[model samples]
Structures are given as structure tokens and as C-alpha cells.
Target: MDALIATVKDNDLVVAFALVGLVMGVAILISKFLTRGKFQASAIAIILGLVLAYVGGVATGGEDGLADISLFSGIGLMGGGMLINLAIVATGFGASFDEMKKSGLGGIIALVLGVVLSFVIGAVIAWFFGYRDPIDLTTIGAGTATYIVGPVTGAALGAGSGVIALSVGAGLVKSVLTMVVTPFVAKYIGLNNPRSAIVFGGLLGTTSGVTAGLAATDKRLVPYGAMTSTFYTGLGLLMAPSVLFFAVKALVG
Candidate 1:
């Protein structure tokens, strides 16, 4: 037992992989049992992962959550932008390029609409919450677009840390909602092909949410939806702290 423990410790990355797989398997089983296939396994796993991260943070008093534990150091790398982006690219290669050609302008429209709508919604919420600063409103609004964009916009705009955290939380809620709701709405929204997938991805813009939701809807659509969804982040990063902030400022101030 000691030898095996030492071996796992020596190869912490392998342990991280194993732990993630194990947690995912458990999450899948729980999803299947609880929802009877109504809810998505990946969505359940994401929620479970978040809960565990919270618990880990409370237990360790560390800001990085689960990654703060020495044994889970590998999670930081596994979940980093590099690996996540690599996965997105890999999945994108599985997409049909011909269908992508079909989506061209519509996909661009969706991206624009998605970022605008999400940012507006977030900014509105911030306003209702009594946050009057342009920086705070923009940061939180950008967060509604996506968590990554939230912090980036906040840092660029010099927003305080508390506002940035709120922005991240807003993005997380949107991601979870997208993941949980997509499959139920897939048919009604005409999310049946690559073109719709691209539009859907653009509208939601959270890569994990759009990808996982599309995966549950149709595995083939994951790449299509995620392709536009991936661009959503970059576009959001560009728009949030600049044009969106100025617009919100003009409206409120």
C-alpha cells in the first residue's frame, strides 16, 4: 500500500487523470440514476466538480480550491487554458468543414448577438445590485458573457477584486444553465445540424457549456457549436472592456 501510494505521488499527473475519470464515472452514474437520462452526465459532473472544489477550498483555506491540495496539483495543469484549448481544437477537427461553410454569416451574427445580450443582461444585474461604477458594471457584464472574459475585462478596466469575483460567478451560473437547459430546448430551437450548432455556440459563448450541451444533443454537433463558442470568448474579450463599457457608462453616467 505504501509503495503504491508512493508511486502515485511520484506520478501526480497520472493520479489526477485517474481521479478525474473516477469522479466523472461517479457523476455519470448519479446523473443516470437521478434524472433517468433527463439531465446530462457532463453537466452533473461539472456541478459535482464545483461542489468538490468549494469543499476543498473550505477545508484547506486556499483560494485555488482543489488544486491547492498537493495531491491535486495536476488539476491546475489539466484544467488550464492550454489543455482545454487543445481539446477544443481536437474536437473542432471532427467537425464537417462543408457545414461550416454553410454557417458563415449566420455564425458571425449569432456571435455578435450572444455577446451583446449576455453583457447587457449582466450589466443590468449589476446596476440592480447598486453597483454604479463603469468598471464594476463592465467587468460583471463581461463575466456574464463568459468567466474568462470577466477577469480579463476587469483587469483591463481596473475593477476591484470583489467585482471580478462576481463576474466569474455570473459566468459560472450561465454555464451551468446552458448545460442543463440545452438538451431540453434543442429540438424547439432547431439545433439539429452544424449551422444551428454554430449559431447556438455563438449565442451561448461558454465553450464548456456549448460543447457539453451540444454533445448531449448530438455528438457530431459538438465541434460545430464549440467552434463558434470558442470564438465567442475572444470576441467577448475584445468587446467587453471597450465598446460595451463605454456604452454602459454613457447610459448610466
Candidate 2:
């Protein structure tokens, strides 16, 4: 038993992949049987992974979550920025250039409105919480656009770690809410077709949230949604530190 455990630990990367696959398989089965696929297996897998990571952190009393354990060290790499960027690029590859073109001005409008609205809401919340600094306000506001945008803005503007963490937390909350609420609200929001999906994705710029939400609502819409959400993220990253920061400074400082 000890020797087997050691061997698995030594091959942790492969084992991590196998474990993730198994978890995803189970998530899919449960979603199919119980929710009739309304809940989305990918979202379930994400929640499950978070739970496991929390448990790992609590059990080991370490900050790195599951990756702090010897047997699960591979998870750190699997979830790192390199693999994350690769996955984002791969998702982009799934989008059809022709369909994106069909989205036209509506898609572009959605991206602008979405980023602006989300930032406004986030900035208001920061103000309510007594965040007076322009950098902190802009960083958190950008984070609401997407988690990726939050840290990038923070780093570019030299925001403190505490403010950056709050920005990330805000984005994380938005993502989880989007994932859980998408399917239930899909019909009411008229989110059935490709054009609507693109608009919705821009409004909710988190890649995982938009894609997973679309996956739950309609698997066919994922690519369309992902494309606009990707652009929204990039736009947030660009705007937050420059225009957004200056506006906040002028308004509040």
C-alpha cells in the first residue's frame, strides 16, 4: 500500500489528470440524471474542485490548497497561468470567424455596455465600502468585468495586494453567480440563439462563467458566447488602468 502510494505520488501529473477526468465523469452523470443537464457538468466539476481544494487546504493547513499535498502537487501546475492561458486560447479556437462576423455591431455594443455597467456597479460597491483610492476602485471595478481583468489592472496600476484580492473576490462571486443562475434564467432572457449568446457573454465577461453558463443553457451557444466574453476581458484589462482609473480619480479624488 505504501509503495503504491509513493508511485502514484511520483506520477502525480498523470494521476491528477485521471482524477480530474473521473470527477468530471461523475459530475456529468449526476447532472444528466438529476438536472437533465440543466446544471452543467462543467460547473458542477468547478464547484467540486473548489470543495476538494478547500478540504485539502483545511486538512493540510496549507495555502496552496490541494497542491500543498505531495500526491496532488500536479494540480498546481494544471491550474497555473500557463495551462490557463492555453485553455483560453483553445476556447478561442472553437469560435467560428463567420458567426462572429454575423454578430456585427450588436456584439460590439454589448461588449462596451457590459464592461461599463459591470465596472460601474463594482465601483459603486467599493465606494459604499469606503474605498476612496482611484486605483483600488478601478481595480475592483475591472475585476467585476472578469477575474483576468482585475489583477492585470491592479498590477498595471500598482494597487496593493489587499485591494487586488478584493477585486478577485468580486469577480469570483460574479462568476459563480453567473454559473448557477444562467440555466434558470436562460429562457426568460431570450438566450437561445448565437447572437443572443454573444451579447450575453459580453455582459458577463468571465470566460469560465460565460462559457459554463452557456454550456448549461445550450451547448451550441458556447462558442458564440466565448468569443465576445474573450474580447470583453481584453477590453477591461486595457480600460481599467487607463481610462477607468483616470475617471475614478477625477470623480472621487
Candidate 3:
């Protein structure tokens, strides 16, 4: 047993990959058998991950969640910003300029509208919650664009940890909602083509949610949606900390 434990610990990253794969596999099965594919596997896996993280935190009283248990320590690195950014870049690699041209002006409009709407919504929510500071408002607003943007904006603007956490929560809620709701409304919203998928993804601007939602709606649309969503993330990262931050500060001041 000691030898096996040491072996597992030595190859913790491989174990973490296996663990994530297992969770995804199970989530896929649940999505197929239980939900009949109404809910996406990625969405289910996210919910399961959150539950496990909460449990791990409560049991260990540690900040790193499941990673604090040692056996799953590699999850910390595997889920870190480096790997996340790499995945985003990898997703972008699959995009084709020809396909992107099909989206054109509609895609650009969606991207701009998505960012502005999410920022306004997040800022309003932050204000309603008694956070009057520009940094807090901007951080949370950027989070509504995506969880990644939230932390990046907060760090760049020197926002508090609590505000960052709130921003992450707000983004998570938007992601989950996007994932859960897209399929139901896809047909009604005319989300039936590559151009529409691109626009939809740009509007939502949550890569995981947009990808998973589009997957549920139509697997063929995933690449198109993911492509624009990737650009949306990049644009958000560029605008949130600088342009949006300054705008909020000016308004608040």
C-alpha cells in the first residue's frame, strides 16, 4: 500500500488527468441515461466538481480545495492559469479564417454587445450589493465577461480578495446559466448555422459555457461557436482592465 501510494503521488498529474477523465465520463453517462442529453456532460461535470470542491474544503479546511488532500494535489497545477490559457490558445488553433468571414459584421456586433451588456449587468449588481468602489464594480463586471477576466481585472486594478471571489461567483452563475439555457432557446433564437453560432458565442463570451451549450444544441456548431468565444475572451481581457476600469472609475469619481 505504501509503495502504491508513493507511485501514485509521484505521477500525481497523470492521476489528476485520470480523475478528471473519470468524472467527465461519468457525467457523460449521466447526461445520456438520466437526462437523455437534455443537459450537457460538461455542465454536469462542472456541478459535480463544485460539489466535490465544497466537500473537500469543508473536510480539510484548506484553501486549495481538493488539492489539499495531497492525492489530488496535481489538480491545483492542472487547473491553474497556465493550463487554462494553453487550452484557450489550443481552442483558437482550430478556427478557420474562412469560416470566421461568414460571421463578419454580425459577429463583431455580438462581441461588442456581449461585453458591454455583461459589464453593465455586473456593475449594476455590484452597486446594488453596496460596493460603490470603481475597482470592485469593474472587477465584478469583468467577471461577468468570464471568470478568467474577473481575476485578471481584479489583480490589475488591485481589488480585494473578497471582491474577486464575488466576481468569480457572478461569472460562474452566468456560465452555468448559459450552459443550461442555450439548448432550450437555440431553435427559437435562430441559432441553426455557423454564423449564428459564432454570434451566439460572441454574445455569451463564456467559452466553456458557449462550447458546451452549442454542443448540446448542435455538435456541428461547436467549432464555430468556440472560435468566436475565444476571441471574445481575448477582447475582454484587453478591454476590462484598461478601458472598462477607467470608464467605471471616471463615472464613480
On lDDT, the leading prediction is: 1
| Candidate 3: C-alpha RMSD after superposition | 3.6
Ten contiguous residues with the weakest lDDT in model 2: 87-96
Per-prediction tally of clashes: 0, 0, 0
Question: Which pairs of residues have clashing backbones in candidate 3?
Answer: none
lDDT (tens digit, per residue) of candidate 2 on 1-253: 9999988888888888988898899899988998897677876776677688778989999867788888889888887768866865675665677877988678899999999899999999999999888889999998888887898899998999999888988998898788777877998999998899989988888877887788767777888887788788888977888888889999998
**lDDT, candidate 1, 1-253, per-residue tens:** 9897778668878887988999899978987898897777776776677777787899899867688887787887787779977886787775778889989899999999999999999999888989898889999999999999999999999999999999999998898688767877998999998898999999999998888777767778888988788889999999998889899889986
lDDT of each: 0.86, 0.85, 0.85
Residue pairs of candidate 2 with colliding backbone atoms: none
Highest TM-score among the candidates is held by which one? Answer: 1
RMSD (Cα, Å) for all candidates, in order, is 2.6, 2.9, 3.6
Note the residue pairs that clash in candidate 1: none
Which is better, 2 or 3, measured by TM-score? 2
User: Which 10-residue window in model 3 sums to the lowest lDDT?
Assistant: 87-96
User: How big is the positional error of residue 139 in model 3, measured in Å on the Cα after superposition?
Assistant: 2.6
Q: Which portions of model 3 show Cα errors greater than 4 Å?
A: 36-50, 60-68, 74-97, 180-185
TM-score for each candidate, following the candidate numbering: 0.85, 0.82, 0.75
